[model samples]
Target: MKFGNDRNSSRFRLPPSTAYRQAMRYDDKTLVVVGGSSGLGLATARAFTAGGGRVVIGGRSVERLEQAREVLGDAARTAVIDTGDTASVTRFFEAIEPIDYLFTPAASYTIAPFDHPDEAALASPFDGKFWGQVRCVRAAAPKLARDGAVVLMSGAASARPPKGAALYAAANGAVEAFGRGLAVDLAPVRVNVIAPGTIDGDLWRRRPAQVRAAAFAGQAAGSLVGRPGSEDEIAQAVLFLLTNGFTTGATLFADGGYSLR
Candidate 1:
């Protein structure tokens, strides 16, 4: 909710007060959002569009892509990109022109306990998120603007995990570590990761209404801020990572102190 951050405008952009007043407009920027059909990715796309940026959302579902396109209107476009598939990823990036930013919030994982976990099961989360990110980066790197950046999605669970979530935690850990290494590898392209705490997003909508409400309440109470995070809050963190030229190889947490709790 706080818009006083430096990403709105930098300190060198005339008076300090003017920076706060300036809207965070992307104008000429082209942002490609993978997994953007819904949830955090879609929210991020909306933020960039509001800032006057052109956005192309990527996902596998034609129906979902159309839904996103309908909601995002003319300022946004959608592509059927299955980031977990090598051929799909290669084709997706191949068809696109150069872009200024890449935001990947795509993820899925099994919830089974770690007791006697199968090798195939162990690999599922990694294949889905960890390697998917790797392939997306590899495919998108050449097309990315030299001065532009990429924002990878990680979770607070990567650092602090509850029971039945170890695999997910590990996968997210790989993403953060990979992002730092990628930032080093890519140099001036500026790669960073966002380790968000639990937010009330589309993923939560799958549960029954009362269950979802109770779960949100529980998570909110556990956080120091006494509330669940909004998707827009996480989107702001994504925007910060993309706009702040000085930041790179950093994992920014917007978890409302959930990690502390």
Candidate 2:
């Protein structure tokens, strides 16, 4: 929560240059957060707005978009897009101009035992998280600025998925793989993925208070940091992928070293 010098962090420090400076500051830059209605996506959209960037937030919910706009003030813009649907994806991009940075933190995963998975449960995660991002990238590719960069959201589950996430794991894995391949096809337009570990993201907030507390505690015990990741922690990594000019086709882990365990 410190919001310290995230740009100069030891892991992704960049050399001083005009482009580097502009990339770091976001002034006059057009940054889009596809799932910016709430949670980590909104967190990142706020970060960019704070850095003097022009922000347009897209999501499936209108109420959340209004809330985000209220939180972001006049610096933010809003759009509704359900990345799971191809038509929604195409229409969303058509209404927007070229973008300098595109961040897709929109994701939904269904946790279920593979033994008795329902059809909707099996497809919902991929529909939103995996194909959602894929649809966004493909739709926006032609509209991305020459120096544009993209950051896709993957999860630690792709690497060390647990027992109850057979389909979710495959979806995350596909996202990472798609990012790597797209980096080649896109040529200079940078494409990178971030695989976050167990974080207390908004998805968990709807649970009862006691259930939330116990779940967080259990997650904390498994991390190298002895706690779950904060939303700001993941936002820092997202900014790194957005600004670091040299980073492409890379999958950075901000999972508190949980995968190693």
Candidate 3:
């Protein structure tokens, strides 16, 4: 099941003037994207940069950060960060003073039977992915502008739990809940989560080509659109959430209808 682009089917749109304005919107604004080295994070950074936003990307890998900076061009900034470390999180935030948007697409996962879950595997996902976002927000909240927004990544697992995904499912669920709670607490500084499902991105490269193709086929069989989602599709959704002032405490699903299955 190959994920195809469907630009004509997009649910959101900006008028030519608005788009032109947005294309020049980032002249003075700054955006910090944690985990922006790849996948949805990288896509989101690209979208923001295209609209003239200055983006600072943070991740655990220096090589990946440099690579992302090269890909994102001169407007893109890079920082070394370990979400699991509170001090690192503080240092990363302190380095970037005024931020207009904080997007965190960082997360880890462990798959195992609940009867015999690995403790080490569970620690990273919970501490790094789950708690990492939480701490980042807490640290950045004070500096976030009144109109600023914090976008966190959740997944379809939060809504549609699969077999052998106990740890991941629970962690995603917590992310969803955290977004809602943070929205109320952070008021006016909008908070939201993107719960994408089976999106076509580099994250799946770990699987063999044939195995991944088969999994995508399974996704298409269950999807309302009959295919997995592309990186741009998810990027569009993230852009909408970032721009829509009326929406907050929401979970936008870009899962190609897999949650409906």
Q: Find the candidate with the highest TM-score and give its number.
A: 1
Instruction: Point out where model 1 deviates above 4 Å.
Output: 1-22, 259-261
Worst 10 residues of 2 by lDDT: 15-24
CA-lDDT, candidates in order: 0.87, 0.85, 0.82
Compared with the true structure, model 3 gives a TM-score of: 0.87
- The C-alpha TM-scores of every prediction are 0.89, 0.87, 0.87
Residue 117 in candidate 1, Cα distance off native in Å: 3.8
By lDDT, who's the top model here? 1
Per-residue alpha-carbon lDDT of model 3 for 145-171, expressed as tens digits? 999888888888777766766777888
Across 31-113, the per-residue lDDT of candidate 1 in tens digits comes to 99999999999999988888889999999899999999888889998889887789999998988889899998876656545
RMSD of each: 5.0, 6.2, 6.6
lDDT of 2 by residue, 1-261 (tens): 786568767766866665554455778899889999888888888778877888889998899899989999998989999887889989989999888999998766666666654787888678868888988999999999888999999988898777778888888899899999998998699999999887787866877989788767866777778888888778878988988889999999888876345
Cα shift from native, residue 233, model 2 (Å): 0.9
Off by over 4 Å in 3: 1-25, 122-124, 258-261
Window of ten residues with lowest summed lDDT in model 1:
12-21
